[model samples]
Structure formats: structure tokens, C-alpha cells
Target: MSTPNPNPENRQINIIDPAFTLNPQPVYDEVLTRYRVAKTIGLNSPVISRYEDVIWALRHPEIFSSEMDMHVGLGTERPMIPQQLDPPLQTRYRKILDLQFSRARVMEIEPDVRRHANELIDQFVDAGECEFDRDFAIPLPCRAFLRMMGLPQEDLELFLELKNGIIRPPIANPYDIAAAKEYRAKTGKRIYAYFEALIDDREKSPRDDMMTYFTKVELDGKKLTRNEILDICFLFLLGGLDTVTATLGCSVFYLAENPEHRRRLAEDPSLVPAAVEELLRWQTPVTIVPRILKQDWELDGVQMKAGSMVSLLIGAANVDEQEFGAGEGKCVHFERERNRHIAFGAGPHRCLGSHLARMELRVGLEEWHRRIPSYSIKAGETPRVSPGIREVMYLPLVWEKGGAA
Candidate 1:
């Protein structure tokens, strides 16, 4: 909202700094206040921090495209459907994905999601405390998503391991590119192999699930190939598995740290829905989305060359005063009248699993507060969040083992 620094100094932000990952708001505030666009010292990409610029780039994917040839590093053999593609082709795939993830269809999965939420709580509530991320945040979505896809729910642990292997490879050095790629490639193979068997099963007996839908759905009057379904499922493994978990982790952590906000939701259940949106805005789990420039583009006098990657700071934009607080930039309230935050992103590739995510978050929160209404971060233990998705991986929460518990 503040005028782009007319004579801005060279601002270099460490996009992946552990400290920044732990507490990124200060960095975001600094960027939003001083620079419309800055450069990431680690990734070396131009960081678009303003809400307007990020939204414009997202909407106009013709200029700022999502299609990139860097799948190997992302633990994928090929570009995943809809997500890694641009419009027209991307739009067609979305047509099919959108129907499968429509609100009505997501609503049908709600009862099971709610059941799983409460069931996860049942294990930890009696103990009066639990490591929230490891216990609840991860498994709930894993099982629910697997069930929704008609996959074997019993393989949730395997799926979690496989997903983590790709995202956060279990190695001593996080910065070892050779080790990281080797691990990701191995994990990618296993992921493909895992889905290949399931694809065969789904095809042998086409069922009433999303996996089957992918196998049968015709795009541009042609049925999707086996690889296409595998690609879609691969994207699902990344997007569906990680994003919702990140949202849940961040949402629960926020509630745990702020008692009044938690009390408001516990006392008045209706606020849970709005609270989900607010949390999504304030603590955008998927902090940065990568885009490649199809052609040269410039914003705020900073030139971005063609084919270079651009980092759209969704978290920074969501809290920008220009759009959020009428130029205040500190909008963290659940009762706000309007919140056009692109937390799920904007335009043709806006998250395909958003409906399911909202239902999961809303249900996850409703059932969580209903069971454990009074809780907080355990004393003397600092929670740790991840760099990319901003997931609070080690959130220890405690409460009295009675009343709602």
C-alpha cells in the first residue's frame, strides 16, 4: 500500500533463513513497507511482495507462467497436471478436477472427515497433552485424503513417509543437493510405483472415487493416458497431502498461542469458518509459489528477465495494508467484512483442492475445539516451523484432561 520505494535501496531477503521461516512477518513487513519487489539472497529470484503485483502476475499467466521444467527437484518425473501447466490446456484439466472436487462432492466426504478428526482427538485428549503436529496435524488429512481417493487407508503411515521423503528428505545435511536429489528420485520412483499399482486396481474395477474419475475422464475428447492419471495423483501427493496439513498445523498453532482467539472460537463455533480464512490469510501456509516468466516483464522499475523464476509471496500480499487494512497492513481479525486474500492463490491454477481443504479445515477446527476447547502451547517448549510451507512441525499443546477434553 505504501508507495513503491521511489529510490529503494538494494534489499536482499533470505527467503529460506531458518530465523525467517520461524518468524517471517517481520521480513514480510519490511518488504511490504520498503520495497514492492526485492531479491531473495538464497533463491536469487525476484520476490514480488506487493498484493497488486502478485495478483496481476497470477491472473496473467500468459506473461508469468507456471509451466516449468524443474520436476526432478520437486520429486516428479513429469509436470503434474493442472498445477504445472498453463491455461487453455490447464483450464481443460481443471474442468475435470473442479467437478471431482466440487463443494457438493466435498460435502459428501465431510461426515467421514469429521469422524476422523474426533477419532484422532480421542487418542490424545485423555493424555491432557500431545505433540499436535505429529499426532493430529499429519495423520488426519493423510487418512481422509486417501479415503477420498479410494486408496487404502491402512497405508497412511507409508504415504506420510513417502511424502516426507520427497519434501524433507531424511538426510544429515539439508543443503546437500546431490543427496537431496538422489533421495527425491528414489522416493519419486516409489511414489510412481505405489500409484501405478493403485491405478491398475482402479482401472480394473472403476469405482466412485477421484482416482477412478481421473482414469475415466476425457480431456479434449480423448481419455487420459495411464501416465496422465499417475501425474495427477503425483500432484495430489504433493498438493493435497501437504497444503491441508500445513494449514491445519498453522491454524492450530495460532489458536494455541492466542488464548482469546481460541476462546472466541470455542465459545462461538460459527467463527471457526471465518477464523479458518483469517488464519489462512495471516499465517499463509504455502508462503511462496514459483512462476517462470514466459517473456520479459518489469514491475516497480525492477526488470525480470524471460525464463527466470519469480517468487510470489502470498503471505506478504495477504497482509498488505493496501488490500487488507485500508493501508494499515496489520489485519488479523476473524470478523472482517471482506478478505480477498489469495492464500489459496489466484487465477486459472488456484488450488484445485480448495473446497476439500476448506471443509477439512472447518471440520478439523470445529471438531478440535469441541473436544479440546481450552488448550495452549506447552510451557518451556518452543514450536518449530518449516521453511517452505511454514508448517509448525513440532507444536506441543496441553490442556486440562476434563470438561471438553
Candidate 2:
């Protein structure tokens, strides 16, 4: 609740500070430079901010366990499947889950993804201006994944609200424990009920989509329980829908600000793929990932007690000068090479939907620029951006009607 230190050099930062949430890079840069590891305000959890330490902790899940319900007050009885399940049991679910998100599978859907991106663009192209988040970014991934999961597209709005309530609740202060818990508890129950009904339907008459697959897939020679299936659905609903929306919004907002970076990708379409990786590195959406300590551990000489939570600053680590050379002016290089960003994380819990995420970003950027190359942030409008998921809520973009710059 404390005001962010007005002076960047000597100021102490709370990760959940509203100002920090508005724009985190400056604070993260300052913190990582001054103190590689620091503690949160009220939570007091050690936040791992360096590239090497972040990856090291992610790799050693034995010590930094993911099983804990890190969102303490969310009322989750169990961790979401696969990502939260450690090694042995995790390995079992992963074996089947891996095939579902395989490169080949994602590639098979590429054309559909591309088509959907264009379809979205077509809706706002002639207007020459649009609110990028709600119209394009949110729906692009939501509609596509809903089809793949055999869920109704009509429910897109419903899911969007539910997802936001959990991650980006509409409260004066996101770090307000009581408000966040109350919002999450109500939203969580609705989400559970929605998926539970879907599960029941899939059970009676399994269809030809992911929902059916989840119902049929066996683990340890037993069908997944309804709650287990719901957990998987819960993860997919959040992962499948929001991450891409947030990433796409951030990508476009940056590209809008830096016309040269936007022009470079538009001129040479081949660079789109690399641009996706670089953008992801520069504007990592999922910022802090919390891991509970299995036992006493030490990171950068800071001893963490057992059962303590460590927040991994994925956004800060991606821009570490050691890994990626200092970004031009700002800390982003669209052409940076040897970029090993853990934006999706590392170890056994690395994002399963990464390939799909990459494809969506690439296609979304390519199609948007293909239609409107010389775009800029609508003048006089300040976009709303947040830190945790680093999203631009309303990206007002305006461009000339020409195809090329």
C-alpha cells in the first residue's frame, strides 16, 4: 500500500504496488540492478529477479516446489493439474498432455489460426482505428481454442470476465487481500460450475475435441476424475485464452510506439517469427511465478526458510543485460539472438501451450501489419497497462489505409 519510491535509485519497491503494476520495467530494472533479490511488502516473499537465479530455481523443482497453492486466499483445494503436479505424477499427465500440444498439432491448426487472425482484422480494418484488446486480441485466441475444445463461441464474453476476475480483478488495489480473495472465491466457483457441466456433457457423448479427449484420456490406467478434468480445463481456459491476449496487446502497443520496429517486421515478413520471440522476451506477460520452498534453501546468499514462497520475475530476467545485450534506448531488441527467455518458464512446468502461443502472436502480428502497416498509438490516448500479466487493456491504434509504408 506504500507509494512507490519516487526516486528510482534509493527507493524500496513493493512488487504489488499499483505504480509498479502500471509500469514494472523501470522498477524491475532498478531492483535487479540494486538488489537482485528482494522481499514483497506485506507478503515478504523473496522475489527472484535475475536471469540465472530465475532459471536455476525453475530447473530445480525439487527445492522450489510448484505444488503449493501460491495464491493463498483463492480457495483452491488442489493445484491445477500438470503444472502443479511435481515429477512422478506430473510426468504421467505430461506424457499424454505433450502429444496434445505437440509441434505437429499446433502446425495443423496454423492455417485456422491465420484465418481467424485475418477474420478479426477484417472487422476493424476499414474503420482505420480500433480498440485492439477487446475486439481482436481477446477473441482471436478465445474463439480458436473454443473450437478446438468444442466449447461454444457464445461463451467467450463469459470466460473473459471470469479470467479477468481471477488475474486482473476490477478493484482499486490488486494487492488488497480481502478484495482479491472475495473476487476470486466467487469467480472460481462460477468457473468450476461452468466446466463441471461441460464435463458431464462430454462424458455422456464424447465429441471430437479436447473436451472429449480429456474425458477419455487415462492416467495410471484410470479415467481422470471430474475434478481432475475440471482442473485441466481450468488451466486450459486461463492459459488458452488470456496469455495470448495479453501478449498480443503488449506486442502491438510496443510496435505502435516504435514504428521502426513495426516497419522492420512488416517489410520483411520472414522476421515475424523472430520478432515474436524478441517481443515475448521484451514484454513478458506472465511476470511473477511463485514457488514454495520444500526446505531451507539459499539464493544469492539469501537464505529462504521452508514453506516460503519465492516470486520468480520472468519479465526482469528476460531483459537481463548479461543474457541479452542492452536493448536500444529501451530494453527490447526485435533481432536479439541466442535469446533463451523463460517467458513460458522452464523445467517440467514450462508452458505447454507455448507453440500455440507463438503461432498466435506471429500470425496476429503478420496479419495486422499486412492489412495496416503504418500504425501508431491513437494520439492523446494513454493506454492502460499492468505488470503482473503486463497487458495493455485498451490499445487504440490508428493507421493509414495503405498496405505498405
Candidate 3:
């Protein structure tokens, strides 16, 4: 367990670009090859890159605080619902929100999810060509989330805009950051207002939806505060909307490029579930999750001072050769068993929406395989990768008539 190198001079620069222009492979290789865990590039934030160390950091939340305000200099600190809070209180919040995403509950919503996917795909399946991101990936999750949250379906475009502004702030220009902040604030206000109305409505007329559940659930023997409910709703919207969109985009891109893998699942729909996990491991839509050091602690021999920010590179960790079988960890092999990936993260703060997200991916892949059985990227057109708070974006593909189905 060698200590992570901390000297700024020794640290590799731009390994984790704020702009996310480069593929993380080189950075991951450097970190894993040399230190297993090393100081981050550019910002010099401490980075835990290996699968095991990253899991350790996630599990020991007391030492690695998820509180957003501690690292205000990096970006705006939106209260991240249960994500930013630690246990006792975090547990309470999780309990209140977990029911909505429970396996049984998500199963109940599967028909609606499948219907939404079909409806979105129906629009472009016959077009012979379509931008997968805008046509299918973007709309599917946004619409599904709106339906689940009981939000107006018409607000999908606005939701996508606001979510992008907040998550992928333009770090290259100060002006962009300012504009993103403004957009985030504006959209957040509208979202909060809507959640407040929903909360009130649920209070007056209880229903079976998640909003109603939140409205009635007690935390620490008392009803959740308006701000708390608002924060939770914000988390739900952000979590539900962003991750699956990127993932669906990646899955579509992968299948388009790998015709054999696509055909395998198309011919046998039962493989969709296993294929979803492998795609998540290979694509890792959510690349990194940042946590602030709660107290002075020693990790892999390096001494980390309290309050220093450390990023758990979930993407890098998932691809660790030590954990997953080798020959570069990026390859997708759906039949591989014992495939435990950290795409959903780990420990207490591990994705609250993991079950629902998995369901969405499974169903989305099934519907995609059924509708668009064979598609390919256009010639001379390379996919544009957009890495931000997460990775994978704007995957464009075209198929011959009836090829997708």
C-alpha cells in the first residue's frame, strides 16, 4: 500500500481535464501504473483511482465527507440530497426515498418505461437516419423521469437544458461558469417551485406516486422540511435525468459499432440484463464522484489533510485490471460472470436510484435491440465525446430501412 504521491511537481498535469477533452485512458494508465492512487492532474485534487481504494473511500464516508459546502471554491455547492450528507441523517433520507426505487416498485413502472422507449423510437425508427442522442437517448430518460415524478411531459426540453447547465459547467471560460450558475439558479428555482406545489398537493390529496410518499414520510420522528423535500426532489431529477441519458447514448453507440454484440442480444432478449451491466462497466457514464476529506487521514501511505477534496474515479476503478479480468479493462464481454462494477458507485452513498436506473437501461436496451437490430456510425464521422460531471454524449448513427428493427 504505497502512499499516493502528493507533490504538485510530480503530479501529471491535465490528466483529468475540467473540460474532459481527452479520453481518461492515458490518465488512468498513468495513475494505476505508478501510484494506484495519485494526486489529480491540473487542480492537484487527491485522486483515488484503483478499484479497491476507491471502494474504501466510498465506504468510509466519515473520513471522506460528501458534504458539498466544504469545497465551495471548486463550484457551487448544491445540497446533494442524501449524496452530500453522512450517516444517521443520510440513512433517514435514504429510507424515505428508497421505496420509490425499490425493485417491486420499479417493476410496476416497467410497462410505462417500455411504452416511453417505444414511443420515442417510433418517431425516428423509420427515418433511416437519426441522431441517437437527441432522438432516443435524451428523450427516453427525461420522459421517463417526468412520468415518475409526475412532472409535465412538455417540460422535457427545459429539464434537459437546466440539467446540462448545472452538471457540465463550461470551465474554460469564466463567463460560461457565471452563465451556467445563473441558469442553474433559475432552473432550480422553477424546479423547487414545482416540487413545492407537488408536495402541497400530495399533502392535501395523498396518492401513490413518489411525491406523495415524500410528503408523508417522517424523518427523525418529524416531517421532512420544505427545503429537505426540495433537495430530495432536485436529487431525484438530476440523478434520474442525467445518468441514464448518457448511458443509453453509450449503449446505442456501442451496439452500432459492434454488430456481433448487437446481434447476440437482438436474437436472444434474455441477454439484455447481463449486457446492460457490461455496457455500464465499459462506458461508465458517471466518470468520477468527488468527496471532501472530513478529517486528517492516511490513504495508501499519503497523509491527506482534513477538508482536502478527493475524487473517486469510478470509471478508472471499474476498469482496474486487478479486479476485472485483463487485456485492458475497456472491452465489453456480456457473458462474463462475476462482473461487479462500480458504475452505480458503492457503500452508503451508492446511487439511491441504482435499481431504477438499471431497470431503465435493461428495458431501453431491450427496446433498442428489438427496434433497431442493426445500425452503424456514418462514414468519416467520428462520435463526439462530451465528458463533464459524467462521460458519453452525442452518439450519432444511421441504419438502412428496417435495420434498426
Candidate 4:
């Protein structure tokens, strides 16, 4: 194991650029090199980019707090439900929510997921060209999440708008913070109120869905409070909507660009699972996970005082030559055997809805391959969106109509 140099040479690290939006390679490379030499250092904020340092930080939760409110500063005060809570208590909340995302539960939702994907494709397949993000990527996961939570499908648009605000705030403009704050508060309240009523309804008349189970769950010999249940529900809504949306958009974009990779999967239909992992590694939708230092520690050579903020750059780590081998780091191969990537994060904080997300992606890819496998990016018309916390948005593609016929 190579240790980061304590008195390493200073190197210029580029944290941001005006031109780049989707592919943030320069920013990531700079951070990775700097973190390798210095262990932990301050950038836009402090970053802990090396794979080992990040894994250590995630494992040592006591020393690296997951209480994001403290780390996120005044930006967000609402507790992040189970994510913001630590052990024992955190485990309890996670257990209550885990059942909803369990493999069996996800299997139950597969038919609905396929139905939703086909329904969206049916609308746009005839158009021969459509903005995938708007037409398919956004609605598929949004509707799946709604169905899983037993929420009204009519509120999908509202849920998406609010969820995006929470995860990807407009950090470029300081003025946007106030608007984001207002949106957070308003959305948080509305979501809480909505879930609270749902909880009440479930308690009065329980059903087989998640809300009923949440209402009846007890932690440490006491029923979960209304606020806590609402917070958990909000987390589910935000986590499911944005992360899955970005991932699906990125995957579709990859297929459009790499027609060979798309062709292989389209022909062999069985390759969808491996292709999903490859897309996750190549795109890495959830780029960074921030942790607060609870106690003094030394990592990758740099000394750190307690109370410092550190971020794990999953995007950079996924591409590290030391981990993934030469040419393997590139997105060319979709069937790599050892395709373990931290796209869903790791450890206790690992994405709880991973199974459901995978199911959604598999269904989307399978259905898409059947209907619209041969698509290309529109000429002179590039699809793009923000690459901040979430890395993708709009993806436009053109296909020949009746190709599947």
C-alpha cells in the first residue's frame, strides 16, 4: 500500500472550469493527484479523493460523521432521515425502509416498471426522435418510485421538481442559495404534510405497501415519530428520483454514442446486466459523498484537525488505473468481469434502493433494445445539462421509425 507523502510537493489542482459540464475529467484528475500527495486538502471545500482514504472515512463513521447538515452548513437543515442518523438509531430507521427496497419487494415491482418503460417508449418511438431525458429517463424512474411508495402518480412532476432542488442546488450563484433554501423549506413542509397524512391513513387502514409497514414499525420499543417517518419518506423520494434519472440518461447517451456496445447488447439481450455496471462505472452518476471529520486524524500523509469536511470522489476512484487496469478504465467494454464500482456508494450508506434502481434500469434497457436499439445523437444539436452533484440531464437521440418492425 502506497502512503501519501507527508511533505509532498505542491501541485496546482483545478477544482472547476466554466466550459465543462457533463464530463468533469480535469477536475477529477486534479483532485485525485492532489489527494494522493497531500491526503486531504481544501479545494472549493476540502476533498478526500483517494480510494483508500475515502473507504477509511466511510468505514469510520464515528470519526467521519454522516450528519450532513453540520457539514453542509446553513445550506440544508432538514435532517436527511436515515442517512443523517448514526448507528443504532440509524440502523433502526434503515431497517424499516429496507423492506421496501429488498430484492423480493423489487421483484414485485418489476412488472409495473416494465409497463411504465414501454408506456413511455410507446409515446416517443413513433416520433423517430425525442429528447430522452424529458420523454423517457425522467418519467420511468419517477413513476416507479411513486408506485413503490404507493403515492399518487399525479404528483410525479411536483416530486421531481422538489427532489432536484434538494440534491443539486444551484451552487454557481450565491443568490440561488436563498431560493434553494426557500424551496427546500416549502418542499420539505409539503412533503412532510403529504407523508404524514399518508401515514395516518395507513395506520387507520393498513395495506401491503411501504407506508402501512412504516406506520406499524417500532424502534427501541417506541413508534417512529411523524416527523421521522416524513423525513425518511422525503429521503426516499429525493434519492430515487435524481440518482436514477441521471444514471438512466447517462446510460442512454452511452448507448447512442457507442453503437457497437449498443449492438452487442441489443443482439444478445442477456448482456443488459453487465452493460448496466459498465455504464455505472463509466458515468458514475453520484460523483461525491461528503463526510465530516469527528476527530483528529492523518490520511494519505496530510494531517487533519477535527471538524473538517472531506469528500469522496467516486467518479475519479472508478477510473483509477491502479484499480481498474489499462484501457479497462475507458467506457468501451460493457462486459468487464470484475466490474465493482462505487456508483451506488458503499458500506452502511450504500444506496438502499440499489435493487430497485437496477430493476428499473434493466427493464428500461430491455424494453428500449426491443423498440429503439439503433439510435444516434442528433447532428448539430447536442444534449446537455448540469454536472454538479448529479452528472447528466438531457440526452437527445434520433432513430429510424419502424426499425423494430
lDDT of each: 0.87, 0.79, 0.76, 0.74
Worst 10 residues of 1 by lDDT: 1-10
Q: Global CA lDDT of candidate 4, please?
A: 0.74
Q: List candidate 4 stretches off by more than 4 Å.
A: 1-20, 26-43, 70-77, 165-175
Clashes of each: 0, 0, 5, 0
Query: What would the per-residue lDDT of candidate 4 be over residues 219-278, giving only the tens digit for each residue?
Result: 878887777777777777767877788888888887888788888888988999888888
- Model 3 C-alpha RMSD vs. true structure (Å) is 2.9
Native-to-model Cα distance after best TM-score fit, residue 232 in candidate 3, in Å: 0.3
- Winner by lDDT between candidate 4 and candidate 3: 3
Cα RMSD (angstroms) for every candidate in the order listed: 1.5, 4.2, 2.9, 3.0
How many Å off is the CA of 165 in candidate 4? 4.8
Residues 119-202, candidate 1: write the lDDT tens digits.
899888888999988898899889889878888878998999999999999999989999999999999999999998988888
lDDT of 2 by residue, 282-330 (tens): 7888888888899997755567789888788888888777666655424
Better of 1 and 2 by TM-score: 1
Better of 2 and 4 by lDDT: 2
- Candidate ordering by lDDT (highest first): 1, 2, 3, 4
